[model samples]
Target: MKQYNIAIEGLDNGSFQQQGCDTVLRAALRAGIGFPYECNSGGCGSCKYEVVSGEVENLWPEAPAVTERDRRKGRLLACQCRATSDLVIRMRPQPEAVPVIAPRRMPARLLEVREVTHDLREFRFGTETPASFLPGQYAMFALPGVSSPRAYSMSNTASGGREWHVQVRRVPNGKATEVLFEKLRPGDELEIDGPYGLAYLREDAPRDIVCVAGGSGLAPMVSIARGASQAGLLKDRHLHFFYGARTPRDVCGESFLRELPEFGERIHYHPVVSMPGEGENAWRGETGFVHELLRRRMAERMSECEFYFAGPPPMTNALQEMLMLEHRVPFAQIHFDRFF
Candidate 1:
């Protein structure tokens, strides 16, 4: 129950208290400081900072985002280190990265589980506190016996209630998915800390919205679409939703998006299969990667819209390349938080 003070080198009144063993990034974010970060799992290297003066415990020394040069330069990932004592760190902070609803850990109980696909399920949880988050934000779940928390995007819009929904795909032999798919049941208790990530819908933007999702990445995209419709943004802006799955059996976006009130005209849904197997004639839909479909459909309009996407690294990387490198879309127009 001890707390340590964390000081930012140059910013005025830029200091926050770290409670217990929380990471530097979480504590700073919890305090409303917009410290730069993306994955929060140490995958994006966006939270790199220099420890001006402090002793911290490295949580993941071999994190993929940390390179040899970063170590040599005394740079550490804020998400992967815990302050052992009062600390002084230096990093550029962006005011735009601050969260509208700061994160706090709370107890939650699983209320329902519905099957979305053979390997995917939708979980409904009731939390101790009202669920509040932007459409595309994600939460970190501390399962009963898992050593580390797993992050999953929320699939439901914030309704000022206690219910939170997330669609999860069962990962083969994944620790968190094993517990969620096999052992977790209704009434199970766990801890959830969230409303994190910066990829939420930007209602102020005048451009059209393009959402590209693959596999379980469909969760946040659903949230964005629903939120936009609810906020009347879809009335003026079109929402083009692109979903990619391995086969027809994996397709679920059609059903999910249909539930939205704005599914009819303004909402355009496109489902593509990446690998439908040989002689899979029963599946009649677009084939090839989702990014390809996005490029083909959007064409030159890609630069005239706002994009939100989530999926495996490969899919996200592909979208990033196609949008930024190929179409020359402004980096600010595309939103996503990297996670591995």
Candidate 2:
């Protein structure tokens, strides 16, 4: 195996090593370097880097962030590139002041599981030592006899206790969800790793916060809401939370949203039901896409606010497109996490 040295400029001249064909981003992660990234699948542009020297190959030839101009300028998506030779690159730096906990892989025992809604279940995993994670980040859980680990965001803020909380939405025939919803029980042991993703709350932003979540996407939003409330970040800023579900039966976190009153009028909650099912209906809440509701509520103020959204691809993509194209919200003011 041919191994080459990798240097990341502007990160204190940090360096790591990668075997031939390994991406620079993977090398950094393996070396415990907390480089900025989201959606490590080469979709999000958070890992864009400028190749300073040596050869590398783009794994995704059509990376969205790498344009013809960018290719001419020697820029590539770190998540989509592999070092073909010893290389020097400068990646977009993560927020210097952000508190990013290093990831660790270890065993955790299932402590409890309960249905939070018709299709969502709250999972509690107990670790030997208290696990610390930024609000809005996720951990990967590998069930017994399962070959691949499944990633789920924590639904609660970091705590001194040794338990991690996650909410999972059952997917049709999904192996992990099948096991979680049917065959898993308290006291079952599972392996977990992380505190990954860069979509955590930026508590220092000077603008109001608007967050949108759909289905189990409410997990990280739960963490952000509670953490912001406890940190007093909502005292002077308005927090408009919009959660969407197919029907009222799919809605979770009603009690969780009810607690926002503790933060006073600055905090607001809007639960949207997109497709109310036929039960001889009596649903009273905003109806239609959550982004449409957001456009109706604060369309004019989007430019002045910081937006955080996480959900299935279609919803998140639509919302992001609306915010960026229609509302003209600055790209810097909007952040997202998509559960694919």
Candidate 3:
């Protein structure tokens, strides 16, 4: 691996900086610099950065992240470029608190596979590399023959580490997950590249947390809640995680969670169902659209707590607007991964 020195001109950081050998976006994200990116794939063109001088090796030439015109304009995908020489890249910095997990194209064996719900599958991978990530963040899991990777949130948040735990939802006709569901068994191997994404728990912020998730979205929320419980963090803060499901059978681990000592009061689990079955009676929990439940609950104490919304994009985006415009939670206090 050859060393590369990158001098980011016009940036406030400094002049000639030694980049050594690293992918451009991976290096920047590792430094806690907020590099603007979306899919982190060449598909979205979100991580496109201009080359001020020198040259770089495009790791993925046909990355969808950048357009042919931009590629001709010297605009290459940050996620695709590697520091091959003393290059000068004029790109934005990723924000602090964004832990960088350098991707490795390695083989991991399927350790355990469980169904969280009808549409969700909890797949565990045993990897030689350790996963270090913040609670509430996500990563991209790649498999062989798949042109693009699927994004899922980490179930364990261990920074200064590698990759640990994650939860993923199965899409209909989704090749990766479909194969993972049927053919993938313990000891089966597949290719993975990730430890990407942030938008996790803002521990530095002083406020209670209102986490709204659906289906597998509960993975990160569960991880963060468990972390907070273990560390006795946010003792004064209350955690309200409302998981949405169609019926009780569609749900997974609420009983297990309620058994945890710290979860009795400090944490509240509200499982809302859209339609109760015929035999299932005595339903006391909230019902209807999950966001409406959030609206009613958050509307009262909206001023006191911070909001972290996940799950599907439509729900998150609509809730974001509701929290900011309707409930009055400040923008700075609301943290969500709309894309993740």
| Top lDDT hit | 1
Which candidate tops TM-score? 1
For model 1, the superposed segments whose C-alpha errors exceed 4 Å read 280-282
Q: Local distance difference test, per candidate?
A: 0.90, 0.79, 0.68
lDDT tens digits, residues 238-332, model 3?
88877776676666547535755668688887677766566546345677767788777767888788777667656776787788888777788
- Residue-level lDDT tens digits of model 1 in 125-146: 9987789899999998888789
Give the per-residue Cα lDDT of candidate 3 at 199. Answer: 57
Q: What lDDT would candidate 1 get against the real structure?
A: 0.90
- Which residue runs of candidate 2 sit more than 4 Å off their true CA positions? 1-12, 17-27, 30-36, 41-99, 260-264
* TM-score, every prediction: 0.97, 0.79, 0.77
Order of models, best lDDT first = 1, 2, 3
Q: Choose 1 or 2, whichever is better by TM-score.
A: 1
Better of 1 and 2 by lDDT: 1
TM-score of model 2 vs. true structure = 0.79
Model 3 error, position 315 (Å): 1.0
Query: Model 2: which residue pairs collide?
Result: none
